[model samples]
Target chain A: MKSLARRLVLAVPLLWLLAFFVAPFAIVLKLSLSRAAMARPPYEPVFNLSDGFWGLVESARQFTFDSYSLLLSDWLYLDVYVSSLRIAGLATLIALLIGYPLALAMSRAPAHWRPILIVLAIAPFWTSFLVRVYAWIVILKDEGLLNHALLGMGLIAEPLRIFATEGAVLIGLVYAYLPFTVLPIFNALDKQDSALVEAAMDLGATKTSAFWSVTFPLSLPGLYAGALLMFIPAMGEFVIPDLLGGSNDLMIGRLLWAEFFSNRDWPMASAAAIVLLGLLLAPLLLFERAQSREADT
Target chain B: MPRIGASGFAALLLGFAFLYAPIGLLAIYSFNASKLVTVWGGFSTKWYWALLDNRLLLESLWVSLRVAFASASIATVLGSLAALVLARHGRFRGRTLFGAMIYAPLVMPEIVLGIALLLLFVALGLERGLLSIIIAHATLGMCFVAVLVHVRVKMLDRSLEDAAHDLGAGPFTVFFTITLPLIAPALLAGFLLAFTISLDDFVLASFLSGPGSTTLPMRVYAQVRLGVTPEVNAVSTLLLAFVGLVLLTGAAIAQRMRAV
Candidate 1:
């Protein structure tokens, strides 16, 4: 009776995760292999399995790889993949550039101000993300604050087309993900041994050289972590792109959303999503390897 | 980088401005005497007053509060259990898979989870609304809370529990009376962490929320789409205050627990 009750307690969580967490992914996977019957009320998922023994690949289950082929053949999906990569890439670079210096300063600063600055760094996120993004909309509108201030100062005669553009989207994405970049880097930098920097400097290395040789390597764990943190989400982010990207900009997140919602192609949407999930997890696995290597060293 | 040097001070000031200006502008406009957020006429709280009576917005806030509270509590219990189990039973055939699954929600694209759940619910003939939102929020929140509680439980001297068991206590007694009290601080931290995330979630809520179940963020999203009013600022300010209080209470509890 005791063991049975204990098993019941443990089984509750396992069952919960199985039902809600794993079920959704399984549903997606199943939906991907099947076809979408858009004609029905509340579109039914169709998996034809008429062919005995050959049904898995060809006979049934809409065995034609048409959706995958269609998704792959489209130039737009490729564009989305490329654009997501490029935007996430640039955002990661900028975050590193900006975050590195701030983190370095925070690490080296007098201990009194460290916690305050750290809180300040993260406070922006506490405000609703949607609201923050909307604030950007307010700031970057054609006849908005930036232009109003510029026009008042006569910096330009006309309002700038800052909103609903590529630049605006990138700015929003970067702003939102910057803290993720900073926290890890700060943790890494703060824990770095100062003696290493002093030792390099005593050997006549310039401050910059000393930093590159000693401080930077010591903080690689955090650097890699921060980059991975930013890059992973940035690569797949739809919220920022949806809110800020111009009509022409077709990032994969938005593209995937349209596939699932607008196009009603369950198979194609699942294929794209699975591809995305795979792409993200692959790099994460590499990060895990890197972590193990660092531990070994 | 060192003292109150000019360049260092200037850079620091610039960073502060970069962080605050956009948000400060929003707060200011929330009380802006004019319709356009960018336009400054005078100071007024008309928008704040307006939000006081909006039935839809109030209902959404109530729904969000219910979800956040319930999900956070549920996540705490499950996560604490998962933490205890994982820390004790460190390796199994699917340990890495479980770890990955836990971490997945923390970093997975919100859109992916959102649509995935939507499809699952539709297929299962599960209705979309508050219940689905609670389940989804709890899933993500549970992952983070589990990681936290596990670390604390693992770091603890397992001997303490062994000692209790040796002294005639059962495993259940050792867990409840000995283990649980020691890790209470961490449980509090994890719960607060989960609560904040549940409160702030928008994308998942957006997908799962039905006509009567729109959450606070969802409402703010729609309102902002119409146009950001001081009402949003008021709502946001209220949320910020709640976070501040939760964080303060959590820190206080943690410190007291540590002292004990």
Candidate 2:
């Protein structure tokens, strides 16, 4: 009876994940191999169980890799993938540059004030993400706050156009994801013993040198975690680019959305999504490995 | 500890300013009397009043609240159960696979998850609506709850449970009388986090929702794309105020519980 109870506890959530989580990916895979059509449901069915086992064998034989081949042969698709990676990578780098010092400062704050600093860091996150991105539009548009302020200060005669550009998208991405970068790095830096840094200084290393040699290396795991957190979502970001990017900006997420919603090409969109997931799988697996290793230690 | 250098202090100030300035601008503009969001005609409460009469926006807000509540509650139960299994059942078969499944959704791009679930709904002949949105959000939210609850469960002292077990208590009884009380705060935190994520989600909710089930984020996104208006500013300000209140209340409750 005890064993049965234990089994039941495990089975319930495992089955829930299988039904909702794992099965969806399988469906995406199957849909990606099918042919697009104009009919309702929009893709040729991948399996036909009506004719029994032989029917299944026959259907399996009819699966095509044409969609994937199209992705390779078309330069636009490849370009879109590369551009997505570049934008996401740049945004992650910028976020790290801005986030690291702030996190380091927060970690080194006086003990009594640390919680308040952490709360302030996280408070902005509770606001709606769309609203935050919208806030940027208010500030960056042609007649916006930044331009108005610059004109008033005689910084520039012309209204500097920053909206609907790659720069705008970068700012939106960095602003939206900054907290994700800060929290992990703070966790890592905060947990480190201050004695290690003191010891390095005791050995006659300057503050900067001790930080580089002792503190920075120890905080690598947090940096990596923060980068991955920022990069993965930024790669597949649709809202940021759609709202902030120019009409020609063709990131994979926007391309996928266009293919699915506007063109109504389920097979093509699924193919692109599968490829995007494949590109992300490496870093994700590395993250999972690191996490389990941490747990073990 | 060493005091922060002047440069370090400046960096911290700049970072906080960068984070808070845009949000502050939004809040300030919400009260502007001008229809043009950027122009400051004067302060007024007209936009707040306008939000009350906007039927579509109000309806979408109601739908988002329902979905957030339903998904967060369900995710909490499933996630807490998964946490228990991971914490107590040390060497179970398929444990690694289970752990992987729980954590995978955390890093999976929302766009991919959105598309994958949309396809799943279509394949199953399920109509896309509130039910579909709830299912998708719950699946996504549960991973976060699992991560949060798992840490709390691991940090719990095992001796208390062992003592209860030795004193004529069954597993279920010990779980209810001891374990449940101990992990309640973590559970509440997990639920609030899940609710916030679900409420704020636009991508997943957009893909899964059909016809009348549009969420507030979806509505806000559609409007924001066309142009910014003071009405959006007012709605956003109200949302910010609501979320801030909930967060403060949650923190206060947690502090009081800890003190006791």
- What ranges in model 2 sit over 4 Å off? none
lDDT, candidate 1, B1-260, per-residue tens: 35335544555566667767887777777778787666788998777788878999888889999999989998998888777667766576776776666767778788888878887787666788889999888888888899999889879998888888889998778878998899999999889888888888888998788878989888887776666556776676666667778888888989998898
Best of the candidates, lDDT = 2
Candidate 1 lDDT score at position A12: 67
Task: Write one digit per residue (lDDT tens) for candidate 1, span A1-297.
Answer: 656655565576677777777888986776666666656423343433554555544524444456677677888777778888888888899888877777776677677888998988887765567767877877888877888899999999999987778888888887888888888888988877788888899999997898788889889888988888889888888778777778877777888878877887767788788778887887788777766776686
Candidate closest to the true structure, highest DockQ: 2
lDDT of 2 at B117: 92
Cα error, residue A124 of model 2, in Å, equals: 2.6
The reply for model 1, stretches above 4 Å from the true place, is A1-10, A41-60, A294-297, B1-12
Give the per-residue lDDT digits (tens) of candidate 2, residues B1-260: 65677877887899999999999999999999998877788999999999889999999999999999999999999999899898889987888889889988887878889999999888888899999999999998888888889999999999999999999899889989999988888888888888988998999999999999999999999998888888988988888887777777877887887676
Question: What DockQ would candidate 2 receive versus the native complex?
Answer: 0.75
Error of 2 at B124 (Å): 1.2
Tens digit of per-residue lDDT, candidate 2, span A221-243: 88998898889889889989999
